[model samples]
Target: MNNLKGPVRVVGTGLIGASIGLALGRLGVTVHLVDADAESALMAERIGAGSRDVAGEPQVVVVAVPPDHVGAVIAAQLAATTSAIVTDTGSVKSKPLVDAGALTDDLSRYVGSHPMAGSERSGPLAGRADLFDGATWAITPHEGNRPEAVELIRELAETCGARTVELSVQDHDLAVARVSHLPHLMSALAAGTLVDAPASHLELSGQGVRDVTRIAGGDPRLWTQIVAANAPALTTLLERIRGDLDRMLIALGKDDGSGDITNLLMNGVTGAVRVPGKHGAPHTDDATVLVNIPDRPGQLAKLFADAAASGANVEDLRIDHSPGLAIGQVELAVKPASVDQLVKVLTERGWVVHR
Candidate 1:
């Protein structure tokens, strides 16, 4: 926090930039907002993100523009601002560095950072103050980067309620390609299957399809730039998936039920279970207790209160609404030992409990 001692200037007022402004503004820091789109900057300011006025030289300048524009903007800002650490929140790191290198040889004051937090929504209107809470922010400091500048960005991340992780420029690009870019592409590919699907077939779709294609709703233009920027890593991963898909197809064509498809499916289960659970920790074999909740005000609050009274702490939960139905199904995840007690208590309290 001490590293972020002075005023900050955010060069873009999009979701990430506005959210950062909102978070830092709450911390009693003087934040100045700017954007190529004046409307965006004004909207962010109206939302209490920050002020549009620039009083003096800011301590740090945050570049929150699109991935393609990050390098030039950061380069220009680095040259324009005196003694200010320039950092960008671009999802891809390596390409921006390459672009910035072409523009200016000096990068001693520039650090690349990416916050692993966002939604499918965009613009200042979709900005949330707590978007970065409990999120991991990657700080990629290259050779010749100033240690003091790196520390300033690290402290800035902490001030915004995010944990910091260090990664090299190449490593950051590779890691994000695997986890972030690949998933978006996969989701878009899956969702693309439904583009021309028969209306009858699409009507039969369930939560499975929705869950699988959720990230596909993101802005395609932005994603296209991201995918192209990290094409080398993404191509390798996509080839692996294609190989697996080809194997499954070959297995399906055989009359004899070989274990190829079975093994492939089982591998999916193993990988899915390895996905981190709440708070980015290792997954737990938590028991789920489902309760049918009526669509009524205060019903959810009451249910939670009852769960608290039952002395069972729910670790995690999700609510699924049945289309055209007036009720929702609440799945409360708890420690395996508390499942029985939770079910018993909810059932006794007139909740339609399901295992």
Candidate 2:
């Protein structure tokens, strides 16, 4: 399971597919890249991800196309070869299996998987060899799926530096609706709020607003298909969010009885704390140390070097630039045990440290 053997055919040349190829190829696995767009396949090949030519029988076939196209493409791949095990990286799972009915009835060799990693970018150009490092890659296999085939799929995920998890197709879909699809819809909705705003208001916006709406910049065409394909699950989640918004609105209309607003805000505080922190573990409230950094090329690097010199591991970092000043505030999150030492180290290194 450590190294993938034999030829692996990838039926898409986008970020996930190309990244899989790059990870496998680097480990000396033979990878064959394919895409409906010939140029995309060629581009992935040119990037040393894999070759366009697939000669012999493949040991594995990865279908990494759009959500709606997954079932059809997986069916086609199954029709093309009965020897290889097939898997897909689509977000939705149950719908595709239902769509692929007969093709998946003998689902011994087919599995559905999704890697919990990606930027709001696509195509071969955005592929990274380490895209899946330490990321959870969920695998959903039918009750009758062959164990060996599932093992091979897990091996493929591990080869790409991803942790493997097994989940039912239904559970997988529901989990993603809460954690992924709902977030995307919310981000898009938040970003849409700015569509008609005055230019001056947008100009004054800072990183916090940008962070909330970052995923809104994804390809609309792709996202539309994704949202539509998973509409049932997404709609349910959206309705719950709508209910919360309704409560907040009603609270705003109340006179002298707006305790509901505080309750709603407290609910958000509770929910936000439930989110997993660094390395997918329970959240820990780390100490924040803010330092004023000069607007210079190597200032950030120097700050990190100083922190390392003090042996204080920086758990997380964020930066905010002054509107009209030649400086930025670098916020560093460190363990409580290391905060005092880090502040002392930075102060000695001529950094204006703020706790």
Candidate 3:
């Protein structure tokens, strides 16, 4: 990996920016934190992300501001820095490229990149050094960008511990619209239905609903800016979904015993299975085994130890807590071939195990 140049200035010390600082700090690179909000910058500095008082001009300036303000900041940073490569962490790339291009004739030093990793949490306090570890970072370099500058930005991403995928500005926008923005909108729409839901309905909530609604808990203000920035691409996706929804409604309205609804559901199953699993491998039909565990310390540890002892590598797991109960159900996903031995070991160990 090419070593990152000294004094990388990070603007807008929010979650993404601060995380970059922390990740770069792990590489022993000098990071200068800057934010419009003094408190945010100060908090980020206090957490050892970087110092706000770093001297000397920056070799690279990262604009991690909200989507709406990305272009103007990129333009400003490009104008302010003599030779520093300007890169952004914005989700949408085309808008910023256009926005920055409008303000300046040359975008040679400007590259757009997006880190495909984050929590629902925001702000500097929510930042961490390992945020980008093993995560995908998309780099969208416009035609006008210098090759060396683009390569430096790629090095910066690697230094932050993320793998890089290069795409065109328009291509990056379209890709994120399908993978990120569209899904966020779907999650929000599904979560919206539960706003006025009765307590009885909520009482029946389980891991499935929680999983679907998890990303919906993000800041709405941030999402509004993001979706609006990529309106063209996102609108295209939403229209396709609208067609499916109309078909679903038509199927529901008919009692003709047609298989339209079942086919639509089957389409979802097909797409779900095509989704990449851990380490970007093809999805697998891992067998899940549920174990009733006592709600006490060391119970989970013991379950894990027993599962390890069974010689079945636990692939994935989810814990579903029963309301007002002293027990939790752990759903463990393991290979089908290992399920029998896993179950036998757990059952022999006196665990309340079930398929």
Candidate 4:
């Protein structure tokens, strides 16, 4: 039966776990939330994630503990429940499979799934039912799993509002290393350099620096377990990055290097555009409209209204303002064809518009 008939038992009450509970609750499915920290489970229940009553046998057991604890938790849940289709939300899949496999042999009821959605923030209060909306969820079903068990997990993911991609365990680990784990490590490395910078240098920071280092603010203790679990894949990618750095340094040391730095920058441009746009399709053909607004209430609402008046659908947006500044810049991303009319309308309406 490829159904997410609950009560679904969620073994952790952190952001991802609590968000899953909240999402399932929207479907009127019963969710039983548990955590090593009792207070965490209570907080998750308080935030409408789920109940902490631990009632009824679970139809599905979702192991959402930290990466280091996921395998053991999965094994324990399998033993505790007789017929539940067990799954996990761990970012790294292979390690948990190995760990759980070592602790037990009856893995026919288990599948590994990772919902590629989370925030740099953690804890139950950070949970939101829509966290997985329009997000990608990877499903890695080992050979030991029953066919219907895999389908049930797929249903579980879709019920939580995510698109699913099935890949082998090795492939999933490698893919996440390049797209997720490596990027976090890179962000951490970049952010680490600014730790001891002068106050004057820090004052010049803008959206560029914030964009580069945003994920660096993630919980280091948690990320350490993830990074370590996926170390084999990450090491390969990091070595390639090291090679790129060495070449860049050599090119920079030379005078007037022909096309070396240019080629490096071009490589970046080539890669950046290939990243999928917000709609999850492989397209990035959107232009930005910048409008200056007063840093006051209702300005954003008024700006959006003005943009809508021009018949342009704002695909994405960001607001930027330095500390102590009374004005802000709003970057509105709209389709290219809509940009001209949007800009003209905003400019005619007394907004200081820029491309």
Clash counts for all predictions? 0, 0, 0, 0
Model 1 over residues 1-355: C-alpha lDDT tens digits?
A: 4768668999999999999999998788888999999999999999988999978889999999988899999999988887899999998998888899899988898999999999878999888889999899999999989788899999999899999999999899999987789989999999998999999888777678889999899888999889988988898999999999999999999986479989999999988888888777655777888899999999999999988878888889988878777989999998889888888888899999999
Q: Report how far off residue 92 is in candidate 2 (Å).
A: 1.8
Displacement of residue 149 (Cα, Å) in model 1 is 1.7
Model 4, range 200-308, lDDT digits (tens) per residue? 9999989889999999988888889999999999999999999889889999999986579898889989988777877765556778888999988998888999999
How well does candidate 3 match the true structure, expressed as C-alpha RMSD?
1.9
lDDT of each: 0.90, 0.88, 0.91, 0.92
Estimated TM-score for each candidate: 0.92, 0.94, 0.94, 0.92
RMSD of each: 2.1, 1.8, 1.9, 2.1
User: 31, model 2: CA deviation in Å?
Assistant: 1.4
- The whole-model C-alpha lDDT of candidate 1 against the native structure comes to 0.90
* Candidates sorted by TM-score, best first: 2, 3, 1, 4
Instruction: Evaluate model 2: give its lDDT.
Output: 0.88
Off by over 4 Å in 1: 294-298, 320-328
- Candidate 3 residue-wise lDDT, 154-234, digit = tens: 999989999999999888989999878988999999999999999998999877889899999888999999999999999
Model 4: CA > 4 A from native: 54-56, 322-325
Which residues of candidate 3, in runs, are more than 4 Å off? 323-325
State residue 101's C-alpha deviation in candidate 2, in Å: 1.8
State residue 183's C-alpha deviation in candidate 1, in Å.
Answer: 1.3
Clashes of 4: 0
